[model samples]
Target: MTRATASGKQRRATLLGVLGVFTVHALLLVSRAAWAQEVGTVAEVEGTAEIGRGGRWSPASVGTAVQFKDALRTGHPGRVRVVFQDDTVLNIGDDSHLVLDEQVFDPAQGTYRSVIHMIKGRVRALVSEYYKQPHARYHIDTPTAVSGVRGTEFIVSYDAATEVTEVVGITGRVEVTSPLDPTHHGVFVTAQEITSVARGKFATPPTRLSDTIFRQYLKGLEFIGGGHAESLSAASPLLTGSAIPRSDRSAAFEPPAAVAGAAPGGRPNASHDASDLLHQPPGIVRALQNGNGDLGVRF
Candidate 1:
C-alpha cells in the first residue's frame, strides 16, 4: 500500500474516534439532565428530613432534588415543602412519609399528571392553575382513600393505626374515595369543609369545617419562598385566601340561580356593557342573580 494512502486512512480513524467520544459525552449529559428534570425541589425544610431512594435512606435538606419513587419522611419536628416544575407546592408536615409515585409536567402541551403516595402523616398542597390547562390532574393515595383534584389547595392526613384518612379543603374542592369501595362515588368537600375516609369504606359526606379547626391546620403550612402571597398565582389571579369567603363557603360551589333570559352559564351577558357587567347586564332578564360578584373579584 502507498505510505500516503495508509497515513490518510490512519488520520480518518483518529478523527472518527474523536467524534465518537464527543457524541457519547453529549448523550450522557442529555440523559443526566433528563433524569434531574423529573424531580422537584425542597423549597423549605425544618427540623429533620430524610429521603429514601432505591431502598437506601439519606438525610435531606432544603433544595433536595426529590425525584419519582423517592420517599420523603419527616421526623416529629420536621416539615418539608416541595415545589414542582410548574411551581406547585406540596407542604409536608412532621411525622409524614410521602412518595412521589408519578410526576410529569409539559408546559408547552399543558399536560401534567402528579401522583403521590402518602404512607402516613399529613400534606398540604396548592395545585397549580396550569394543572387543568389541558389534561392535568393530581392524586394522593392514602392507606384508606384516594383523593383527587384539578387545581386547588387541600390537606390530607392519614393514621395508619386507625386506617382513617382525614381530608380538609382550604381553597379548592377535593373528592375522596376508598380503594376498597371502587364503585362508590365520593363527596366533594369545598373550601372550609372537612371529611374522613374509613378503612374499606368511601368518604363521609363533607361537613363544614369550623373556623377554629381550619386555622389550627394552617399553623405551619404556608408558602415560604417565591413570594408566599403568590402561592395560588399559578392557579388563578385571585388571592388564595379569597377563594371562599367566611360568610359564603357553600356559595362558591352552588351555581347562581338563572334570571329569565340568561345564557346557559351565569356569566354576564356577552353583549352587556362592560360598566354594568359586575351587577346588571343587558339581556340578563329582570332578576339580578349571583349576589355581589364579590366572590370572583379579579386580580
Candidate 2:
C-alpha cells in the first residue's frame, strides 16, 4: 500500500489498542464491586477455626470472604474476628458454632440486615449504628431465645446442655425475647446489664452487672493464642465506658421507676435515688469518669 494508506492504518490500530485497554479496566472494576457484596472478611483468626457450607468445612484464615449462610466453628483455643462492610465487628469465641443465617447490605436502597444463628458458645459483637436506620434488622438467634439489637457492643452465649441463652450489653442495648412467644415480650438490656432466656420461657429482666464481673466476661473473648489479651486495656470502650445512644424504642417490660417513699421532712427517700438503675447503670457512669474504678452504688 502507499505510505499515506499505511499511516492511516497505523493510527486506527493504536486507537483500537487503547480502547481495548479501557474496556478491560472497566470490566475489572465491575467485577471487584460485585465481589465486595460478600457479607464480610475474616479480619483475624487464631488457632483452629473452620468455615464452610453444606456441612463441608475448610480452615479459615485472615481475609476469608464470609458469605451468606456460611457456617463457622472454633475449636479449642481458637477465635475468629469478622469485620463487615457497615463497620460491625464480630469476635467468635472458642468452642463456638454459628451460622450466618442472613446478611444483606445495600447502600443504594439504604437497607442493612444481619442474622447470626448461634447454636452454642459465645460471640462478642460490636454492632454498627447503621442497624438503627430504617429497614434495618440485626439479630442473633439461639435455640432458646433471640437477641436483637439496633446498635451495641455485646456478648451472646448459649449453652446447649441447659438450653439457655444469655446476653450481656456492653455499650448500647440488646433486646432478648423467647422465640416461642408470639407476643414478642422481652427485656431491654442496656450497657453493663445482662439477661437470660431459658427453654420455653421468656427473657428474664435485665440485671445490672458490676465492673468486676463485666471485665471478667470481656476477658473471655480475648484471643489467647494471638497475645491480644491485653487489648482490653483502660483505653478500650468497654473499659473506658464510652457512651452510645440508647434505643428509642421501649421494652416490653421497663424496669420499675424509683419507688416513692418518705425519708423525712417532706423529702423523697434517699433510697429512691438508686431506683432508676436502668437509665444510670452503676458501672458505666462510674467508668466514664474513672477507668475500672469502683461503682459506689450497690444493685
Candidate 3:
C-alpha cells in the first residue's frame, strides 16, 4: 500500500479501538445501574399501606422490593418500614405519604445517596452506618422543608391542615432548611432537638422535642417487635442502655422490657452506633407499650 493509504488505515484502526472501548464502558454502566436500582426491600407493611409506581397503586407485601421513584402511602391505621441494603431503615407512619426520589447504594464505588420525599404525614429515618462516609448523603424533602442528616435517627412530620413541618432529631445531627429562604442557609439541629417549618419562610430554631407527644405518637403506631415487626427505626426502644439484635427476638409481638423504659424523645447520649437499635421481625411492627401491645404505654 502507498504511504498515505497506510497512514489512513492506522488512523481508522485507532478510531475503531477507541469506539470499542467506549461501547464496552457504556454496557458496563448500564449493567451496573440495573444492579444498583434496588435500594431496599419493604420490610414491613401494616393496615392499608399502598405503593404508587408509574401512576398505578398496589398493596405492599412483606418481601416487596422497594425501588427508586416509588411513592408510598398509608390510610388510617396503616404504616410501613423499609430497610436498605446497607441496613439503613425508614419508617412511614399512619396516613402518611413518602416517595423514594433517589437511591445509589454502591459502596464499592463509594457512592451512597438517599433522597426521599415526605409529601404528607410522618416519616422516621435511621441513617445507615455508611452515612458517615464523606460522599454519602441522606435527605428527606417535605412540602415545606428539607431535612439533611448524617448517621442520625430522626422524625419528620407534616400536617397538611396547618402546613406545618416538624423535624425531631433523636441521634446524630440534622440540618433543616426551607426553600422560601434559600439565602438563609440552614438551621443545624442536634439530637433531642426539634425544628419546624411553616408554609412560607425558612426553618425555625431547634427546640427540645416534646416527650409527651412523641410517646403518644409511638404508642398509637403500636409497632410490634417480632413476627412481622417493623424495622429498627420504628423505635422498639432504641434507648441508651443495651444492644438489641434483630435476629434474637421471638416471633411473638412483645418487645423486651428495656424498650418501654427507653426514655422517649430524649437527647442523644454516648451510644449512637447502629448496635443501639433493637432487633425485631420484619413485618407490621406495632409500638409495644409495657412490653406488649395489648394496652398503649400510659405514663
Candidate 4:
C-alpha cells in the first residue's frame, strides 16, 4: 500500500480506540448513579438538641438529616427523644451514638422500614401501630446482639465495657437474638419483660418483674407523702420554712441510686435496681451528674 494509505488506516484505528474508552467511562458513570439512587438515604431530622462530637456541642435543626459520623448527645441529663415520620419515637439516653444503617419509605404502600446500628449507648423506642402493616419492620443491631420489632415499644442498650446488650419491652413484644450464635438464638420477650444477650452466647431467659415489684414500680413516683414535703422544706436552705406541696416536694427529692441496670446479657446478679430507677413510671425524672455521683432528681 502507498505510505499515505498506510497512514490513513493507522489514524482510523486510533479514532476507534478513543471512542471505545469514552463509551466504557460513560457506562460506569451511569451505573454508579443508578446504584446510589436505589440505596437508602436519610429522609429528615425533625428535631435534635445538644448534639456533640469530641467535646464541643451544637444545636441541630429540622431538615438536617443525620450523617454517618454525626454523633448524638442527650439534651437533658437523661434521655433524648427522636420522632420519625411514622410516629415512631426513639428516646436516646445521654452519651449515646446511634448510627443509621438503612431507611426506606414507600408512599404508595404506606410502608416503612428502618435499620439502626448502635455502636455504644442506650435507646428507647416507642413503635406506633398507626401505620401497622406486616411489611413494617424495625430492627436494631448492636455489637453482639440484634433486636427485631414489628410494632412495639422497647429499650435497647449496648455496653462497650462488657460487650453485652440489654433489651426491655415497654408496650409490645420483641424478638431478640444473637446473630453471632444463630444455633442458640430466637427468644421472644413480652411487655414489661427484660432480656439480655452476652457477647458470644445466646440470649438469656426472659425476666418478668413480680407483681409487687411492678406495683411498687407503678407507685415509685408516689412513694413519698406530705410528711416528705416538710422534710424537703426543712432541708432546703435556699427556700423559706414554708411547706412545699407534696407534689413539689417529691419533685425536689433526689434518689441516691443508679436506675436501670447494666447490659441485659450481664450476670443475673447484675444490679437490676439501676434498670428500675431508669425506667420508673412517667413524671419522675432521674439525673446522673458527674462521673460516680448518685441519682439526683428535680422531681
Candidate 5:
C-alpha cells in the first residue's frame, strides 16, 4: 500500500482501540450502579442525622437513604431509617454504627436474606413477609448478643457502660443468644417482652415497663420532630423531678417554638423539640440529668 494509505489505516485502528476502552469503562460503571441499587435503600430520616457535613434533620428536614445491592455509607451521631429492597424496615438510632452484612434475593430457591452488624449504639427493626420463607434469615449482632429475627418489631440497645444488651419485642418473636454459649442458650421471647442478656446468661422473663411508662414512650415519638429547643429548655426547669402528669402530657405535645417556628394559632412559640436537645435514649436521659454529657459513655 502507498505510504498515505498506510497512515490512514493506522489512524482508523487507533480510533477503534479508544472507542473499545471507553465502552468497557462505561459498562463497569453501570454494573456498579445496578449492584448498589440492589443492596438497600434509605426510606426516611425523622430528626437530625448528619448526612455529609452540617446537615441536620428537623421537622422541616426529611431525607432518604438508598442502597442498592451495596452498603449505605454514614457518619457518626445521626439517626436514619432504611428500607431494604426485600421490604424490610430498619430504624437506626443515634450514635449507632452499622453495615449491611449480606443481601440476596432469589425467588426460585425461595431464599431472601438480610444481615446487619451493629457496631455500636441502638437499633430498632421491623421485618416483613420475607421472614416467612424457611430459608430466610435476618440477624443483628452486638458485642454481647446475636438477635435472630423472623417477621417482628423489636428494639435492641447496647449500653457500653454496663456492658449489657437489651432486646424488646413489639410484635412477633426473636431468639437471643451469646455466640460463645451454644448449649446454655435460652428460650424465644414473644411480643411485649423485654429480654436482657449479659455475661452469657439470659435474664429470666424480661422486665416489663408499666403501661404508663410505655405510653410516655409512645408520646415521646413527637419529640422526634425537630424545632423545639428553647421551649423544652424553658420548661425543663419546672418539669424536672416532677412526673409529667398524664393530663399535662397532651399539652406537652406542642412543638417548641424555636424549632417549630410559629404556633398553629396566634400563640407564641414556647418550647423546643426534645430531638434538638437530647440525642441520647431514655437510659442516657437520666445520666444527662445527673450532669453527664458524654455520648460515648452513654452509648
Candidate 6:
C-alpha cells in the first residue's frame, strides 16, 4: 500500500483500539455498580445522621439507599430507621456508630444473611419473619459480643469507653456470644430477658429484664423529632438509676409531636401518615407500666 494509505490505516486502528479500551472501562464500572447491591433504605431520619462510604460522610435522609459495607452514624439526639430489602427494620439511636458488614438476600434459594457491626451506642432491631428460612441468619457484632437472631425484636448497645455490650430481647430469641469465640457457645435471651458482655468476657447469663433498663432501652430507640430534646430531658429519670416507680413509668413514654395536620382536634388536612413518625406503638405506655409481653411494634 502507499505510505499515505498505510498511515491512514494505522490511525483507524489506533482509534478502534482507544474505543475498545473505553468500552471495557465503562463495562467494568457498570459491573462494579451492579455488584454493590442496595441492601436497605433509610425509612426515617431525625436530627444529625449521616451515611459513610469510602471513608467519606454525607447527610442521610429518608429514602437514602444503603449498600453493603456502608457505615451509619448519628449525633446527639439523632435517630434513624433503616428498612432492609427483606423488611428487617433497624432503628439506630442517638450518638451511634454502626456498619453494615454483609447482607445478602437470595429469593431463589430462600436465603438471607446480614451482619451489622456496632462500634458504639445503641440500636433496636425488628427482624421480619421472612428471615426464618432454613439457612437465614442475622448478626450484630459489637466490640465484645455478637448477637445472632433468626426472627426477633431486640436491642443492642455498645459502650466504647467501657468496652461493654448489652443485648435486650423484646420478642422471640437472641443468642449472645463472644465475638472472639469460634465455638459460638452463647446464652439465649428471650422475651423480657437481658444479657451483658463485658470487655474480653463471655455474655452474662440471661435474666429477667428490669423495668429501669427496659425503659432506657426503649427510650434510646424512640423517634425524636423537632423539640424532642425537651422530651428526652424530661425522661432523664428513666435513663439514670437502677429502679423507677411503676406509676412514674409513664413519664418516660412521651409521644412525639403530632404532624402539622394530624392533631386530634385539628381540621382534617393532608399530612404524612405512617407509624414510623408516630414512633410509639399502640398502648406502649400501658405495656411499660403493666410489664406485659405484648409490646411488639412493626416499625
Which candidate, 1 or 6, would have the higher lDDT against the true structure? 6
- Off-target runs (Cα >4 Å) in candidate 1 are 1-37, 223-299
Task: Output the number of the lDDT-best candidate.
Answer: 6
Give per-model TM-scores.
0.63, 0.63, 0.64, 0.53, 0.54, 0.67
Candidate 2: residue 107 lDDT (0-100) = 50
Question: CA lDDT of each candidate?
Answer: 0.63, 0.67, 0.63, 0.51, 0.51, 0.68
Tens digit of lDDT per residue, candidate 4, span 47-95?
A: 3344433345555432222322235654334344443434454556655
Candidate 3 stretches greater than 4 Å from native: 1-36, 226-299
Assess the local accuracy of residue 285 in candidate 3 as a C-alpha lDDT between 0 and 100: 24
Residue lDDT tens for model 2, 1-299: 99999999999999999999999997665544432234555656778888875457878765455655668999997888765655576888889999987666655556677889999999988777679897788999999988888877788999999999889887778888898883578889998898999999989889999989987777658543333422333443333434333232112112222222322122322221221222232333333345454322111
Tell me how candidate 5 scores on lDDT: 0.51
As a TM-score, model 2 comes out at 0.63
Q: What is the alpha-carbon RMSD of candidate 4 to the true structure?
A: 17.0
Cα lDDT of model 3 by residue, 71-125, tens digit: 8899898887766655676778889988888666554456667888888988777
Comparing 3 with 5 on TM-score, the higher-scoring candidate is 3
The lDDT, on a scale of 0 to 1, for candidate 1 is 0.63
Q: Write the per-residue lDDT of candidate 1 for residues 1-299, one digit (tens) a residue.
A: 99999999999999999999999997665544433333454545677888776577877654355654668999998877665655566788889998887666554444567789999988888776767565677899898888888788888989998989998887777878889774577788898888899887778889887878887776666554332433323322122112322133112112222211211122222222111211221111111122222111011
Find the candidate with the highest TM-score and give its number: 6
* Candidate 5 segments exceeding 4 Å error: 1-37, 50-65, 68-78, 182-184, 199-204, 215-299
lDDT of 5 by residue, 132-224 (tens): 778788888777777888887677777777768877766788888876773366557666677777755654466667766544333322122
Where does the lowest 10-residue lDDT sum fall in candidate 2?
248-257
Q: Which stretches of candidate 6 lie over 4 Å from their true place?
A: 1-27, 223-295
